[model samples]
Target chain A: AQTVTQSQPEMSVQEAETVTLSCTYDTSESNYYLFWYKQPPSRQMILVIRQEAYKQQNATENRFSVNFQKAAKSFSLKISDSQLGDTAMYFCALRTRRSGSARQLTFGSGTQLTVLP
Target chain B: SAVISQKPSRDICQRGTSLTIQCQVDSQVTMMFWYRQQPGQSLTLIATANQGSEATYESGFVIDKFPISRPNLTFSTLTVSNMSPEDSSIYLCSVALGGTSTDTQYFGPGTRLTVL
Candidate 1:
């Protein structure tokens, strides 16, 4: 079984500033994938970024980047130059690399990020 | 990336009523999944909708309560049976373009069901 934990239930950042949301997970599978999804007020789950465990280098997309500490089992997301549109519920999820019935994602509790103007 | 859409974006139902949520993907996908998100809660996997076979449900979920049907590669439906206030939630469907485990699953807009 895989469990994802997001310790911070809420966070706030100023406009044009940066913010980092923390996420930790525990899984037995050696090969796996991690992801950050943002659900805005529109109730749409949008993919923010993804990280592959096999890759030593961290993954970045535009202003979104992940600080993946494999040994610590930590995968945190950092949003630079935060905008009001960045306000949303952020969830961290983990998926095993194995096929069959275990392809579903195990999501964290989620953190509500608010970007203050 | 895949574009997924869900039908009946939001609906309200009385107890004991049943609601069937539809999920449609713009392109054919190998894997489709159903998930439920309670108020202020994270998403939980309900089942994996197989293209031709019966859906594979999670530990706490059963086929009887949440019957799923996947008639083809681009469409699927999930029915919530014997609904109660507890069953009221935001139901979403996700699709993975590739059948492989490494593929990223993209989600639908979701159906918000409010049971009265």
Candidate 2:
């Protein structure tokens, strides 16, 4: 069984500042995927970024990036020049592909991020 | 990304009642999943809805308690049978963004359930 963990329960960042949310997971499988999803006040789950385990390079979106260290089993999300809209609950997730598998996504407890102006 | 929609965005139900939430996707998707989000918590996969076949439930969940149906490629439903206070949570329907899999899971707006 794979377990994803988010250490920080709550985080705050000043407007235009940067903040990094930490995430770590335990999985025996080699080929898989990691992701960060954001849930805003609207309660809609939105995809922030995704990283393939096989890729050595990190994944970067417009305002979000991840520091993925597979050996350390760590995948962290970095928000650059944070905006008020970036205030949301961020969740780290793992996707596994088993033999004769129906790939499923598993999630970790979220970190509530508050962007203060 | 597929556009997924879930019906009965929210509802208050009696403890012994059953409520079925519907999910529809704008485009055909081979795989769909149902999840539960307890208040102030992370999401948990409830089951995998496979088109034209039975749904595969995860541990700690079952078909009798939360029956699911996937009649087609773009639609699925989850019914919370004999609801309890513990059943109160936001139910979400998700689908893979791609046909070949390994794509990010796209979520619906979510259906909030409250049992009295």
Q: Which candidate gets the maximum TM-score versus the true structure? A: 1
Report per-candidate DockQ: 0.90, 0.71
Query: B27-116 in candidate 1: lDDT tens per residue?
Result: 988789999999999998999987988889988999899999999999999999999999989999999765486788899999999999
What lDDT score is found at residue A107 in candidate 2? 91
TM-score of each: 0.98, 0.96
Which ten contiguous residues of candidate 1 chain B have the minimum total lDDT? B96-105
Supply candidate 2's per-residue lDDT for B27: 91
Q: What is candidate 2's DockQ?
A: 0.71
Model 1 spans with C-alpha error above 4 angstroms: none
State how far residue B70 of model 1 sits from its true place (Å). Answer: 0.3
Docking quality band of candidate 2, CAPRI definitions:
medium
RMSD, each candidate, Å?
0.8, 1.3
Cα-based lDDT for every prediction: 0.94, 0.91
